[model samples]
Target: MAGRFFSVFSRSLNQPFRSRLQGLMNYGLSCCVNALLQSFSATWELVDLLDRWNPVDKYKESVPLQLRKVLLAMQSDQSQPAPHQDFLHCLDRNYIRLHVQQDAVEVFLSILNLIQQQMSDKALAQEIQSLYKVTVETYLQCLECTYIESGTSFLLSLPMHIKESHNSLEDCIRLFFELQELRDRDNCYCERCGEKKPSKQRFRNSRGYTRKLHCKVTFPETLNISEILTAEALSQSYVQSDSQYSLCAVIVHSGDAMFGHYTAYVRHKKDQSWYYADDSNVRQVSWEEVQNTYGGSEREGTAYMLLYRRTPEGKQQEWSSG
Candidate 1:
């Protein structure tokens, strides 16, 4: 019951990471997909899931097939490089067109959906989906009749909103679950009373544009979101499970919406060493260096998506800039 859910998207102590990560060549403005692949490489859990499954159809145009091959090829000891050309081509055929500045989250979700749709093994495909699922319950109350309706919902990722001023990750998460009251023009039709009435949505839940926020948002290397869990979500949980999340990988963006560069700071699965992957260049980086992505200006690289590993273990980060 450890709400051990991975979100789309934490500090380590002193440890020098020198493991050289294989870099992907930017084939036809493939930086966006390259960054995502780097992040996925760090997700050894996902790699293992795909490894356990045997694809019935090995079509070149199939996304999951290409992805499985690429992921396995990445871990190969063979000196031959694991070019993602076929994977990219498969993606292009799937309408994730080549040579376009793609949004990382959208691409990430699309990949997940494609796996579910295209994979022959339905059980294994669902196993992959359960790895990143977030469970929540919503409560809606009508003001006029005092009628109430509640339902459970699932989410794959959480999007954080940045303000013009200071921001904190904890505050952002709390705000996402904060109850909202709808009044005035915004009213819900109550089924019991058959009248439009003000309502309160208790429980709950970025776009684009080239405009960048210069706000300084503070995010932690280790996070525990159990405190923000709604009473309903918490009630269903009979076991007191650990919900601490450790920082694993972060996708950083630098530039406007039209023209931006994507890079990833990923933690090695075997060694827990941090490495930075930028297209064809791969270099070891420290935890502090990863924190630099917290942007206070347009020039500073901003964290686009963060990947965390839920753990019962305390922060075991050792900091030593290599």
Candidate 2:
């Protein structure tokens, strides 16, 4: 019966049997990686960049190399059931353990970091890193003498702390940029004053563009930076144009922080349609159904990591039903 079905299916060229969405088999406890792979698949730019890499002989077990292979196979029309097993094994050889629960955010960052460390092409390596790099300035201001010390740093992902009560993504982001007063035991040693003094620790300047929110924060399907930016942030040198971002992918956790399963809802780039991908099972979904992930109730999944893409100015955002 299976052979007859394949024969008939192959013969119907006019009605081609092409799958719009493909699934990856769950090997051991690999749902987390599977979810990430769906998001990575949605990001075609990353895939194209990875395709250009030509690594030397030393780094054969490179994560990016195996990842490129797996992504290509997953997108192909092959008959293989488990195309990602070898990629999973490669990650295991790199010390990302199999059969163990993993944090989606940490694993995602680890994969990018591995690409940075293992890729032989230095120029292409930095290009991949710049895709998600967020630059910010940290400053320490002394209260007694009005002295300030500042430094700049970059983050691959912005980690925001969530409140126990209801929280919005914009509020969480605004609070992350807010200045905090440090007093008493938290005072810093002043160089000119030569003693411990009260001060303020705050982010001075930030080049906020595309960002990843790492918390149980509820964000809208479309996010505008017009309201989220504070007066101080607006006055900074890096703040240029207010950009609008659309939610492209979400990494969801079903259980508690300690034990959970990972899945993803990724929006297609060409069609702008939503698709839910659980390990080895992929299905088309609606925008309203995607909203069901907004946490605040029981038995529903919370968003662990969010992926947003900046919408180009003057272009209409088209979201069509699949």
Candidate 3:
């Protein structure tokens, strides 16, 4: 029966078998292509509407009217075509665009606030943190853009410079101390005069030693070396001291550099003013031998390597974990 039916149907078509098969395939492909085109047209229309819609006025007024028009157009009458889906899609696109613009505005305001230090001034270091927060939010907005990965990473890294700037300064100071050369000379004092002339004392730490003679008991306003020659002189004076090298490292928690606490290492030498130790020529010696022997005992800690640098204004501060 099936064979007979196929014979009759084939005769009725009045076309070759391959031609009929090709015709069916072409019809199916056309349907698929048409569906794809319709969907794309719908999406493009939505994008166009979002691009033109004004959230503050035009769009707000048009949305309700558009929805009502779409519903009314869906009447049983065959003459008018209803665009219910397109109207809804347009509404959603407008909302998403508005949200994106709002986020961008918020991020821009935050950047300005940081410039003004409104996050709270130097009395507390909250400003750095607030600025960092603003930076992160900006990065999130970029994630919604086209060039996501690199753009986001670049923005995120901008705030990280605050940490790097602090770290670089500490490293430079440590290097200077490690390469500092101190001048040593003997002192003769009159014991008879309770006008007792003060003896020279050398204080050694990571950088070099401070020599305080009877004449001057305080640090100089600036480091005594000239920039160009200082490096060379420091190279000649680089002595590996067994005295524990004191360095400063900033502690950052939750993307914030904690400036409230500080750590320092101190060393004491016989010549209290400033002079090099005898066996300071080797690199990486035991902690006890080169450790800043004077002040570390006063502070409580598991004793880690310390890095120190002058503050921004070149002021010397005795940083306490306090």
Candidate 4:
């Protein structure tokens, strides 16, 4: 069944797929959510999981229920223009207001949290949650003593802080895992020292698996992390088959930090091609077009959130089978 679906999906990509692709109506400044929905549609794994959910009642008020409906409607051959109005209303009812500028990364995290909170099926909810979970172990070493504190936590999307100057996706990712010195006023409280003292903080991958990072920093189309991650970090994880990742989706923000519009460039999974989606219009694009979002220029759209998939090990597979 999966193979058949991929075959059809691939054919659609090669054809006038944009004509069949439905666009969301921007009701009261809904471009942010609309852009996100485009990326969500591209993430077929998420859509498949959402399809398995069966909500008995209270569907109108449930975020996941509304999301599932909207995604399905968007992919359908129906003539309805504004299919995501209910999903937007559902979000508004859940306190994510409309007619306001939103940060894409924050909205993405909120959607994941909503799914974890509102989904009725426990196992399915967990499956959805695990789809983007990034597990890391944070270590805090006391400077005064040798006492070290470690804790394991999970992030649905890793947030990388960006610098003012030019930066690469690989640098930002490595910086996220790099150790930092916390000294003077920024000291941590040490139980052994019974006082605040200088310390070092670092994080490493906890287990072997593929994870997602919604890089807040601007990133190029192709990202190679072979030289970024330290050997120690890679040696600790068995899932580190390859250190290369291809851009699957890019959530773009245009204008200043205070006010902006959001759009997305999503790559079709089966065909490995790019498409740009802005509110109600989507068009086929190339790799050069995707690089335009790297953002070092003025009055141009900048990449606000990035969605990358690990490159598969075998030459025949474009992406990981999982």
- Best-fitting candidate, scored by TM-score: 1
Candidate 1 Cα misplacement greater than 4 A, ranges: 1-18, 77-81, 202-210, 228-235, 313-322
Local distance difference test, each candidate: 0.74, 0.72, 0.23, 0.72
Would you give me the overall lDDT of model 3? 0.23
The residue pairs found clashing in candidate 2 are none
The candidate 4 region of ten consecutive residues with least summed lDDT is 1-10
lDDT of 4 by residue, 1-322 (tens): 0000110132343554344345677899899999888877777778888887778766687999998888777666544454788899889998888887777778888998999899889789898777677677778989779798877777777766456577787787887778888888778899899999998887433344422222234465555565677875443553655555666788888877677789988876656667788888867789888888887775678787778765544444443324
Give a tens-digit lDDT track for model 2, residues 188-219.
Answer: 88878889899887643344453333234467
Candidates ranked, most accurate by TM-score first = 1, 4, 2, 3
Per-residue accuracy of model 1 over 85-118 as CA lDDT, tens digit each:
9999999999999998888888988998999999
Q: How many residue pairs clash (N, CA or C atoms closer than 3 angstroms) in each of the candidate models, in the order given?
A: 15, 0, 26, 0
Q: Score candidate 3 by TM-score against the native.
A: 0.14
RMSD of each: 5.6, 8.0, 33.7, 6.4
Error of 1 at 318 (Å): 15
Write down the worst ten-residue block by lDDT for model 2: 1-10
CA shift of 263, model 1, Å: 0.5
In terms of lDDT, the poorest run of 10 residues in model 1 is 1-10
lDDT of 1: 0.74
Q: Candidate 4: what lDDT?
A: 0.72
lDDT of 3 at 44: 21
Per-residue CA lDDT of model 3 for 70-117, tens digit only, reads 333322222222244444344344342221212222232332333233
Candidate 3 — which residues are off by over 4 angstroms? 1-310, 313-322
